[model samples]
Target: MTNPCASEIFKELSKGSRNLTDLTGLGGIDIFPGMLDLFEQSGKFDYKIKNGNIDPRLGGKTDIINGVLVITLSNDYLSKATSLSVSRTIIHETIHTYLHKQLSYYTRTDLNTFELLDKYFKTKYPLKQDYQHATMSHFLLGMAVSLYNWHKNFGPTGGTLGFDYYYKLSFAGLIKDGTSELLDEAEELIPPGSSWSDIDKIIQNEATGNYESKGEKCK
Candidate 1:
């Protein structure tokens, strides 16, 4: 039950830098609004944006309950993050919805396998509600940011405007304050193969603006 739309959005967004004029034909953020529309109309989920303090660690979350998928984004995130960064959050939550839906269809045998994996994660990480899947989500966020940086030509950290840049700056500050342990733990779980080095190579290869025709290899 792979989500082709999600895959396609990732592919398009991975293309190199473009301006508003460049957004018209394709390979631009314009596709985002349409994708959101499609997802909403599909009747599989309801989306909500709330303004309030969300858990500082989470910008967005997706929950599937009683046959309804609910995607919630923190109001603080909406108020502070750049449009592109917010779009990335939306994309992240969409993928979560897709993955969760895919898992819900699994047979009991598959459920057993997932339970075993969960137990293994609990034994290995000793963390509650945070483990491999969280790491995978971070990796996905990395994938999204890498694509964004490449496509938008973000300088060093992120474009001058956005939570992406602010988040990186905040990371540095967190380190100075001796509170980066959580960030460090999250960074450590970026799946060995999907390391930033791998993403760097991807950016280098697509520097020539050839990503439009490329298939997603990060997943």
Candidate 2:
């Protein structure tokens, strides 16, 4: 099947700017049912209204009672936001969910080596600062997300990535603190003899080292 977001391609029409404070066309992002499916697949995001008022924060929310998603917004946002806002919102939420799912995977690995690491090393050598470790999965997943965002906002080369509402990350060089060679670095980590099948499996799968998922001990 075609990509779910395919129909909502921004190329079909121009998306004038829309701000979060101004809530018009905000509901437009929900036009693609799959987009909703994508979001739902991530966690528990429910449509809710209570006490006679719509929640106004786009800040992320989690359903503590059941472990799900619940982002709140106003009717004005649903009615007045533009396509750009909707697209960015979907992309942003999708990233959050993807990370959650992968962490779940790591939490399940039962390798003994992983158990040993968790028992003896992980806690002892815990993060000392910015000196942190990244799973291959996290790195590549980030690369993919960054690249897709680049495409969504910037489109193809000679295309635009602006939102007039909020900044959509564009080319890497635009960042104030880091180099833009991230994509290149992630791609280079591919195993030398790996095939497309190798690519199909989790990118973070390493020959050694166990991973933690959902705060559970895993390998």
Candidate 3:
């Protein structure tokens, strides 16, 4: 139950935190894993770069991890995340710190990784192009990541009543995470009861562009 990301705890351990060169350089953790504070709309987490949960100064900065990050995420996160989500986010940001420590440019290529998605969906839209120009695919991927994790955990037993409840609950996060306004508009475009099909379509469009980029485009 220790708040490892707290500055008070950090100051006792390290003399002071250093500025990371970029997001990729951050790695290591001072905070105890499996720890959490009550999640809140106004609440934020702080991590020291050398070791902690989240850097408090990462506010307003999308690509760099030089300063601390105060991640005041949307309320949408509540539905999809359990303690597990926090763990994953912690590891994710940690990787950014580690890589950014040695190099420039935090790893962003994977942020848009849409490999083999087109063949799965098969669409006419340029999902990859849209992904590059707009953050649409990023939203989709983030939603997919959470969904996939949830499914991986409960998907085997046809899911429990509790699991199903959680899935429906997270539906809002699916929309809110990054795809809200876009999802709302797109959901309207889609007919009810075929949401999965529509989601596939978007993936297909994106995958096609991805293959094209490799010069080995899929048919």
Candidate 4:
């Protein structure tokens, strides 16, 4: 059974996903169609969420067992994290669920271009330790955009937060052994004239700072 706090977090995530799907144009490009798919066909996804003991440093884990997708949010982390941070972790894990579903069930007749690209990357870099993160790095902009929209519509208000902040948050759990190189590759997507060093500082500060203390608690 989902804990009360986990249920609330999932509710917020659903609202954010629905908001994205209901919008049009989306700044001239569909930023998060995969998220739309995950929510729209949620009944078919066999996904579940629960709070549990996990690594202290981790916010959540997406696990596949017996054909089920289980997202476990660290109870300790959730207790301390703000609503926005918990929301980001949910989004990150759900993206992993989406990729697993897409790649595992893909067929040539029904495959989308994104799935094709996912397949190509998996094949090309089969031995990468962070294959999922590597594939997801190519699509961080979409995650960033979705996060910003979610925050704007359903999260805390004020303080001049923008896409750059959420964009850095989107990178929280994605920087790892096989996927760290993609961060350098993604520098092109950063704001014009902004160096990776600038982004690195933002990511570092977010990791170490107590900014979450200032935001609404997930409870």
Across residues 109-196, which tens digit of lDDT does each residue of candidate 2 receive? 2233234334323553342111112222223323233323433444433123223112212111111112222332234444466433
Q: What local distance difference test score does each model get?
A: 0.38, 0.28, 0.28, 0.62
Let me know the TM-score candidate 2 reaches against the reference structure.
Answer: 0.29
Model 3, 1-219: lDDT tens digits are 133322232232122111111112113312221111111100123334332233332211123445753223212222223332332233233322322322324522221222323322254334432222122222322222333333334233322323222222222322332333334423443335646454443332222333312111111
What's the TM-score of each model vs. the native?
A: 0.40, 0.29, 0.26, 0.73
Ranked by TM-score from best down, the candidates are 4, 1, 2, 3
What lDDT does candidate 3 reach at residue 90? 32
Output the TM-score of candidate 3: 0.26
lDDT at position 216, candidate 2: 11
Pairwise TM-score winner, candidates 1 and 2: 1
Off by over 4 Å in 1: 1-57, 105-122, 125-128, 132-142, 149-219
Q: On lDDT, who's better, 3 or 4? A: 4
Candidate 2 Cα lDDT to native: 0.28
Worst lDDT run of 10 residues, candidate 1, spans 169-178
Best by TM-score: 4
Candidate 4 lDDT for residue 68: 84
lDDT tens per residue, model 1, 84-121: 34445544555455445434544222343245336535
